[model samples]
Target: MNYCVVGTNNMTASQGFYNALFAQAGLQTVLPSERMTYWIGDDFAFATAEPFDKKPATHGNGTMVGFSVGSKEEVKKLHGLALRLGGRCEGAPHQRGPKFSAYVRDLDDNKLCFSD
Candidate 1:
């Protein structure tokens, strides 16, 4: 079945933090609302919500949402943008043999990663 994943977090900053990261990777923002936003790519789309209480669900720990890009430069660009948008660098971008990878925390402390 076709499916999409949406994550809800207590966020003071809305989904702007995620929007910036997707934008840097040249992905389009497909649907944007006051409390939620979506990033569209060929393989999948990601949605995020800004919850009123500003707390993330307890189930998200050890879970990571990964985005795949075309090049290492795109990974670096997205990682840098995430930092500028209130995301903390969990891991800096680097080569993992054939792939470049990095991890970062969104405004709500949810871990998001990228690889190329």
Candidate 2:
């Protein structure tokens, strides 16, 4: 995919949360605007922004963004980092069939998961 965009109602809080987050993963911000910020890794690029339609941004039900770190250890570290950075834990890291997974909700209530 080209990129994924998540909407934020509180830009400062959301941006701060994402800044701390992507930094831990070593993702670089490729674009920044008053209303948006984008980060790029080798595989997938994601961003957060204020909605263009002038409406309060709300989380989409049943939608989630997933990240893959290379190992279960990295998943744990990232999940911990997320919680420390104002994210709420949705699921603790664990074996899921054959993969290890963890879930969290961002400051904007966007669901995110890390897998290995």
Candidate 3:
């Protein structure tokens, strides 16, 4: 897929979370707005939006979004940056066979993984 999106209850704060989080892989915002913003990477787009019905956004129990980067060091650095930017650590950087990965929850509780 070329794009992915997750819901947010607090658009402002969630935007901040994604802004700092995606920068680790050098993604840049292609579209920015109060209700939604889309960040474009070399091969994909990622985004966040407030609920259209005005209900509080909630995380799916087992859903996750993953970003694959160029190297293990980038995975580690992004994971650390996520934590420093208010994301919660779900898993620290570690290698499992061919993949080195780290997991984190965005400011709005959306699960995400950084992998290499």
Candidate 4:
């Protein structure tokens, strides 16, 4: 996909968490504005934003964003970092079928998966 976005009620906390997380993951920040913060890597982009409707942002049920982060070690590292940044563990790093992956819910409870 070209891009994905997750909603956040607190832009400051979300920006801080994602800034540190993406820095280590090698995504570069781009086109930041008051309502949205974006990071781009190669052909893909990711973002966090306040809701456009002026309501509280909420995580969608059964929706998740997945990243192919290159290896098991990187998967583990990002998973740990997400937790340290106030995300909750959804699943620990492990082999899931052919891919090694880990899952976490962000500060805003958006589900994310990192895989090798």
Q: lDDT of all predictions, in order shown?
A: 0.71, 0.89, 0.85, 0.93
The weakest ten consecutive residues by lDDT in model 1 span 1-10
lDDT, candidate 4, 11-114, per-residue tens:
88998999988886678887567999899888889999898998999999999999999999999999999999999999999999999999999999999999
Write one digit per residue (lDDT tens) for candidate 3, span 1-116: 87888999887787777787665556778656678888886788888988778888889889999988778999999999889989899999999778999999998899999889
What ranges in model 4 sit over 4 Å off?
none
**At residue 33, what lDDT does model 2 achieve?**
71
TM-score for each candidate, following the candidate numbering: 0.74, 0.92, 0.90, 0.95
Candidate 3, which segments miss by more than 4 Å at Cα? Answer: 24-26
Candidate 2: residue pairs that collide: none
Question: How many backbone overlaps does candidate 3 show?
Answer: 0
Ranked by lDDT from best down, the candidates are 4, 2, 3, 1
lDDT: worst 10-residue window of model 3: 23-32
Compute the lDDT of residue 34 as modeled in candidate 4.
91
* Per-residue lDDT over 46-85 for candidate 1, one digit per residue giving the tens place of the 0 to 100 score: 7776554666544377888777777898899888888888
